[model samples]
Target: MRDPFAPDFFETPVAPEPPAPVEPVQPVPSFPHRPARSMAAAMLAAGLVVGSVAGGAVGAVLVSHRNTGTSPNAVATVAPGVGAPAASPGSFAAIYQQAKNGVVTINASTSSGGPRSFSQAEGSGIVVDTQGDILTNAHVISGANQIRVTFSDGRTTTGQVKGVDQSADLAVVKVSVSADQLHPLPLGNSDSLQVGDTALAIGSPFGLQGSFTAGIISGLNRGTTAPNGRALTGMIQTDAPINPGNSGGALLDGRGQLIGVNDSIQSPVEGNVGVGFAIPVNRAASLLPSLEKGVAIQHPWLGISGQTLTASTADQLGLSEKSGVLVVQVVPGGPSAKAGLRADGQASANDDVITAIDGHSITTIEELTQYLDTKNVGDRVTLSVTRNGQHISIGVTLGNFQAQPSATP
Candidate 1:
């Protein structure tokens, strides 16, 4: 090591010459733009995977909220009125041009419980307002210590988390960017979205900036677990390719309106395999005011963990039909528990099976929760269930579902 205290150390050192300026490689949204996964260092991992035991467990990428916290709520779903009339998409270039600048890249540095240590994760976001507020998925910025939003023109700035609804997988992040830099995407009616409707996703997948993917609405009214295992109902399903870094990106309709926030992709390889999921923009729009005001969003809970019965599982139990969710466990003092609903205490063949709710047939946990979405807390619901081979109706007042820190991933 050189001795800095020496008298000769006072001499000035010559500065090195600056490198030549290189042309910036601008990412064109109209063309394919996906960066290899290796470039996106430390991408966050998603928890939920879709599959049966037979096909071998495949890992899809809808991340769970790692933070141990509480958020509870009425029916499982929350939204405003249905969307507007479907518009045709003959202008792909026009749609991309209109929304491109609004799309941004988010770099979140989160603490991993170690001192002076952090992990970097990337996700996509949209400018939701002129005040510098941006909308992104809750999990993308969850537990982040610092957030940076990079715009299409190569501008980056610090961000702050305004509010988060883990149950709904939605969040608002406010940045210090200039007002002129913000171009809020227009909110579209997700309820008006139909199967086969044109859908496009714009995000920074695999750290590739301004990447866009196109597809059609694959399904609707689908139920999936949120970051904390609370049910999210009426989700927009699409075949648009989404990857690890695509979380919090936009899912637009044919008319160039923001219809959903891309969140999950169902694939055996943790890559896009044609099936993906988004949080309906209508639901997100309905909660934006609350989120901007820094209020925690809530959803209804049933107080029980259920297993959607499958044909194989039903055959193992000798059931004539595998239609209903099997109650595995019920929260004590919960609404269901207070109403005398039973669970399969010992994995017995005679577990309490919910056959219907308010006369609506429920074959899967998704169906049961989807129906509850239309209901509210303190509402009385009649559940038709089979207990010990006997059909009976149980009236239970609904209770809010609480978030568990240890909700097993």
Candidate 2:
């Protein structure tokens, strides 16, 4: 063998130290690489499977809860922005206070043949002025020898008759109360009053002094017949509580102004039936200034009983083309008779139907009276009538019914 270093051919290339044991290099990792389509499909399938089960369970619970009962939050409640509705008592109280002061309790006694004879009646009156003048119903003081008025302040005084309008059921009385205690209530315009307006009545009903009641205006321009067969025109109807002694009291508006004078009540029971009538203050006031000045009042009278022209009557009288009043009957020597106006006499002839007075169209007796009211007692008026299928005009001078005194007391 050769040298030991040169060993054998098998171990020959052992390799020169194996090339110094070449170092192996390691590769770097990238972001977790995945197949995008495959991952997305798997996630979608999982979501569908979870959503189906959860949705069904939630629907079941909602249905069960709905069938059980209403939720606590479902109850109704008033809103903070709203308030309850009510009426104001201030208006009513103020009107009552102002009107009651003008109201006075009236008591009258009529004498028979003997000194022991006594017939007493109680009523209410309104103070018209500081001069001690008072207004009451004519029937209250009718045939009375002595009359007394009691104020709310407990002052009583003897009353003297100034004058009486039997037709209107109004009378004026005079008392000697001081001016300090004589505050007259402000009068309002009743003609402008509407239905359903608030009304207040103050009086001494049943001798209960300073009694007050409240209501609303139920009607207007109502026609009422007196017990003596006299017709009261232009009456105001109300539902205010009125009793026996409320007559001649004051009917006031919400503003504490006098609107009317309480005159009558329609009741079948012992208490109020809510049907009451009053004379409009405007109508009554028109006559007040004259009476206060001691001027005699002369009421104009048409002197004929008539009625509203109904459709049937309108057709029968050939008034199909017109609307007017039909004169039923005429009194002898009355104003209409003196004016040569023909009425339904023994001869059944269709006299001319009155269609208008001056320029006003006559419809009801109330309408006719209202037209007549526009003129004075001695004033002359022209009536437009539909007669014999022709229109004719007639001039008439009104007569004073009050001027004719009753032959009997």
Candidate 3:
């Protein structure tokens, strides 16, 4: 399996003054290859880059900082959740008009090593409520000493990072402003979105504020890596021409309701190649309560890596299970190891095949991951496993996903 964290496989744009380089963390182990399909190959071809558009001098860099501390004094106002009405699809122009005001331009400045040197990063954000709670990508404000938010009405104000979840690449910024100065966008159900469904993206692309683009939801349940090298599953893939500075922007449906957050682009070059990935709004909405409270969100980690087993692959490998996840490696001292789950050894025999989790059948990595996403850290779950053709259930406790330093040039 090829390394997905290879230098050439991913790039992040940084600007103005470059910060001191940090040590690159080790890459996650590769999963077993499928017979005719390889996820790693596809990722390599479509290089992933953090889509925060940079101004001034551009350089290749990726910076990630994790802050899980709670702030008791911080307060945020979240928009009320409303279901999307059953209305006819609106035109892109109509959608833009409805959602443009809810989007804002974000500028974050990070201090360099020098006493007076600082670097600026620019991206877009969505106003979730009239009280000035804005949602953006975590990478946009990571390690920032100061933040500035520009509203659609040309109003600019100082912003504060209320909360950030780097594992999901999401953050919340708050500003002190009157309710009349804000326009909150309603959150839509991303699960209702389908292939060919209309997707309108509004953001500051290349510092172009209020830039709007139209495309269809090209794919669903796509998996990608976050800026911190954590796996982000159940992503919404689109060809909406999302560029740098579009990060943390809104991906709305035809009804002008927010469905996803523009996160990253898959392009060999720095520019968009019509392939962009967005974090599902449902996930973002789920995290809003905790994020708005200035409480860092911690994702549940299973602490194991594996590949989805198919009928063809099972027959080829002479395995017992036709469809399941083949446990290739389990991290020592991790939750799976603590639960006594067996991993494939050097002999590749006696490997444990995970068929289900808490009575939910999982046939693909995406299914397993999506199920896990709904769970909280420290939750106890039962894993249905098949080891040497014997079925058994193992109870395991989940743990928080630790952010690792990723290799970024």
**lDDT for model 2, on a 0 to 1 scale?**
0.60
Index of the highest-TM-score prediction: 1
Give per-residue CA lDDT, model 2, range 89-135, as digits (tens): 44454446555777898887677778777666667888766667787
In terms of lDDT, model 3 sits at 0.68
What's model 1's TM-score? 0.74
Off by over 4 Å in 2: 1-91, 115-117, 225-230, 267-271, 314-322, 345-352, 388-390, 402-409
The predictions' CA RMSDs to the true structure, in order, are: 16.5, 43.2, 15.2
Give per-residue CA lDDT, model 3, range 69-157, as digits (tens).
Answer: 23122434556886544322354545576679989988888776898676666778888765567888877787888888998877899
Candidate 1 clashes: the total is 6
lDDT ranking, best first: 3, 1, 2
| Pairs of residues at least 3 apart in sequence or in different chains that clash in candidate 2 | none
lDDT of each: 0.65, 0.60, 0.68
Angstrom error at residue 16, model 1: 49
The candidate that wins on lDDT is: 3
The weakest ten consecutive residues by lDDT in model 3 span 37-46
